[model samples]
Target: MTNSTWLKSADNRVKLLIFAFTILLLPFVALSFFTFPTTDDYCHTLTVNDMGYWAYQKHYWLTWSGRYIGTLISATQPLTYGSYFGYKVAPAILLLIYVHAFITFAKALSANKLPTWQTALLAFLMLFVFIAEMPSVAGYIYWYTGYYYTVADISTLYLLAYFFRHYPAITAQNIIVLSLGLILLIGMNEYTLVWLVILCGSLFFFKSIIDKKLHFKFLVLSLVALVFGVLSVTAPGNAARAESGLYPTPLKYNLLFSLKSSFTWEFHNLSKMAPALCVLTLVLIPIACILYTSRKPGEFGFFFVHPAFSLLVFAIALYLSYFPSYWSIAEPPNLRGQCVINFWTLIGWTFNVFVIIFWLLEKERIRPILSLGVLSWVVAFYFFSLYLSNFNYRSAWSDLLTGRAARYNKEMIARTELVLSTKEQQVTVPKLKNMPYTILNVTPDWDPAWASVEVNNGCAEWYFKKKFFYK
Candidate 1:
């Protein structure tokens, strides 16, 4: 085929890939309609309603967690106003935001050489792998509390995109916007705070070295983010909560365990998902090559570091994310935390692979060997294997096709009705008969000894203004 014809064919194939990936994402979004509030949702609703928004924020800062933005979100959760529909639609909205941010970042990274639609196709592929490999779909995406982490995650992408689009000559407006964005990112959660500090610090260090001069803007941004991070970490609530026995591990043990478990979980998931990750890396190679070729000479100075240095930085950032959870909670990060880690893993790993490819391409001896036709077949085979092997997507489809999601929604509605209508202050509800994997089910069984039962019961009672229990 002629070069022009091949280029046109490649464009058409990318469009097709975009459509296919969109179709694959539909089940996850469709599952959102059946989502309901769970443990923390009820607790947050009751606390925020009782204390008022600002007071709730103060309460969390002084008594529970140092996540200032997180508390703000908790104070205004959709369920705070008894909007079940709002609750159900939140995950879908978050998913859309994530999609937009990823595409925007991709465009910026490629210096807008890639068409918007092609960037979107790239985003869809990454998001697909994220959903497929995430440790907890329901907790990380469906559950309101856990999914709030996505706000910071998405903001990070946008902030980086903004930086990439207007670096080294960032205007005053850009600085102000980026500073505010950094505060938002640092206050949402500790994991992202650490990641941001490291990211900005590393950029500041490397950019100075590459350009042979200081970059004051990055230094300013890093300082701003670090100040907020310090405020978050030093909040009285952190100490209070630590002593409250929620995290009973001693500091020594916590440190030791975190050191060991960080590497353990990282390697475990890396090994388990190697095949899928390899496929994703293969798909990203040509795209990365395109990005490398499109960049103006001497642009993105910090991005073209040696592969060994990039890998080391990636490993450090990844491990730091694990350390905060282990230190505070005396356990590995929960699935929600792992969700953030896994998302970053995919992103960072992809970038690291790109760095390697860029190094090879710069040498003029290496070129992408696979033809577009062959790559398309590989993409097709990937989705086929993904459909067959991805438990999260399979479970999502099962929940929808088997009517489990509908039944679960119906049952929750019935339970809510029972709570509202019963004249008696105390109400007993039946156990959930259909538990969909796509939705978080926080209803405790008959066993009161269950860890979350008391908290769930208390929140349910407060929210319903009645005594609530389940058989």
Candidate 2:
């Protein structure tokens, strides 16, 4: 075969692999949803299913839309197994929702100028937020409560992207639109809200000074958003929650401590994290190459010529995004919160990498060297993946991810049968073997023959609710 023909063939195969893997995503996620609830899952399920939603008793902004969204998922328990496909369809449905929403937003950002490959890479980046390969995949994207935040965040992103792209002068109609968008963004997470407020406001101020023109519309929007964020954070419910020691750490301490803890935690886990970093590096390197070749010279959007500013902004937002988690609690954030930080961290890391790449390309003297470096990166990434495939923990994590869905199918059946066939009103279920999908899982603590089955009936009762536990 000619060299060009051979290269084309390989490209086709790569595309095919991407397609098949994406197709595989649905069944994997669906299987997880089929399994029963884990630790906080049951509690959240009960609250959403049995109790009411949108109680001001819960934190107002934090829990408002999230409660409703989670309640929708919690309500799905009974039907999935008893009726239709149930939560088994969750992955695909969520994939389509998120992928479409993101791509649509991305198209708006690029003005539909980006190639399909780059767009697909963006979709893949979004997938990293979920998928078996990620840490706490089930918790962040599949659990009812976790999925609520995911949903809210997606909505927030969509709104922000749309509004930012279409930002205009203050007409009455535009004013309402801008105001509503700000409210929604602020409501998603106070930390993210604060981050954006500072990031966007600073950018606006700097741009105005540079351009010698004040943008009155964005200024008003920023002030209105500040008001919204303030009210949301200071809501009476926040004080009540803080009294429980949940929100005890003050904001000042949170910023300082979060910054300190992030470095400490990352440093401590450097060895353990190295392999995962390798995996991520491998995956991203090729995509970066593709991005470099496809986009024109200096076509980089925000990372244009001045990547230093972009890097600074990303670093600040990373700390701020992590601030709340570190601030309110002495301990580091649990897996759920960590997922958000990790996702942002990944974005920041990759963006910085691209910035370096851009810097190198901007220098005419190093084109040959840069091309050689790109080629080396791709080859090294392949070798790293090849090596990690056999490494103990990496292998285990991959195997666990692959085997989890099937395991869930088996356990759900056994648990269901055990609960259903009990002659007595109460019977304890055997403790379940742990699986990746079983985030925060706890099997019934019981003896082999006879254990107290306090939960024997609640399982059946909860079994009947509507359920789709994907973001």
Candidate 3:
């Protein structure tokens, strides 16, 4: 076959692979909207619903607390969930924002303008987040309450990339966008503040120290973000530490638990590709390569400094955030989750690798061995995402549905009526309250203004007033 024909055939296979990968990812992303909602989902929904009610009653700026957002949603009836009329629409809005951001990023990168191999590489990278099944079943995404922050940050990252492309030197518009991101980061999740700090600080240091282009705009913007980020934390919901001491063990025990969770590739029957370990491996690879080759310092200065410094700084910061000496996972109390921390680490690590690869490819230094290693990593990612995508803890709907008694209770909650049961027909409460979908546990005698229930030995027979949403 002609050389061009051979190249074209190879390109076709790569495209086909990309297509298959995209198709596989489409379902999980779509299904997430309908997948049995999580406990946090309900909590967030309650907050959303409450926000709408509050906003309608009072015209006030919506704080990070779902109070304002929920109140806003409640003003509009159509947005209500099936039974949980108060369920917030923030999740859906966030999902839509992510989609728009991704599309805008693709267009801005001119990803389609690249060569076939480059295009395929970009496509894979673009879908990398989904392939990883981020913040879904993963602890960092699921447990840490990072799902919202991650979604927002992903949008911010797209904006950053867009700014990077259009204006190499920061401009007013870039500053505004980035400042907004920093504000949003601080408002949404505290951990994201660290990420914003790293990005902005890196840009400052990289410009001043490495590139010697102390662009005033960049420096001023970073400083502004840092200042406002600090100020933003003053909000009631956004505090220094989460409610950490409440669940106090010694720092040592907490650290051990966090590290154990972080280090082990497996947790809760789900296997995660350990981002920290992967990073350690990638870091070792270049160090070994450098020692063996002993290439001049300047020859690979960008490769050595940019990624190693950036990733190491972030990883170390994250590790210290869960430190043995002073850190506690329980404090701030607003949201407690550390699950997707590693996913962010993995993202940082992946970018670290990308920078290295880009530098190597530019220098024509991607040797056959290096190329093979890269290809192997891609395959590993594919299988890893494929496996993680299917990992879910719950099975069977019957196990989750409210019993007949609970259904009857819900009907009363909706209609403000009472449930009647004769001596011959016992109308007892179901196990619905234990399920994740339930927002509030309403009893047969419970009032909307003041709700309370008592469960002895984990068994409660009170009739519920209404059906919960997202069941």
Give a tens-digit lDDT track for model 1, residues 316-352: 9888887776676666777777777777788788778
**Residue 34 lDDT (model 1):** 90
Q: Which stretches of candidate 1 lie over 4 Å from their true place?
A: 1-11, 115-117, 250-253, 368-376, 441-456
Give the winner by TM-score: 1 or 3.
1
lDDT of each: 0.77, 0.51, 0.42
Tens-digit lDDT string for candidate 2 (1-471): 584465356466458547744643544444444544443444444554444554422533343322223335444443423432434455446656766666665554444555565555455544533343345555665554456456555665576456535543236667578667666656655444666576657666765766689867667777776777776666664544445544445553556667788667654533444454455555555445545556665344444435666677776666566555555555565665565555555545655665655565655423422133446457546544544563322433553457754575577577657666766655555555535434332234432111112333343345433222111
**What is the alpha-carbon lDDT of model 3 when measured against the actual structure?**
0.42
Q: Between 1 and 2, whose lDDT is larger? A: 1
What is the number of residue pairs that collide in model 2? 13
Model 3 ranges with Cα > 4 A deviation: 1-18, 29-113, 116-121, 125-147, 238-308, 320-340, 358-427, 432-471
Give candidate 1's total backbone clashes. Answer: 0
Best-first order by lDDT: 1, 2, 3
User: Comparing candidate 1 with candidate 3, which one achieves the higher lDDT?
Assistant: 1
lDDT of 1: 0.77
TM-scores for every candidate against the unseen true structure: 0.91, 0.69, 0.58
TM-score of 1: 0.91
**Structure candidate 1, residue pairs in collision:** none
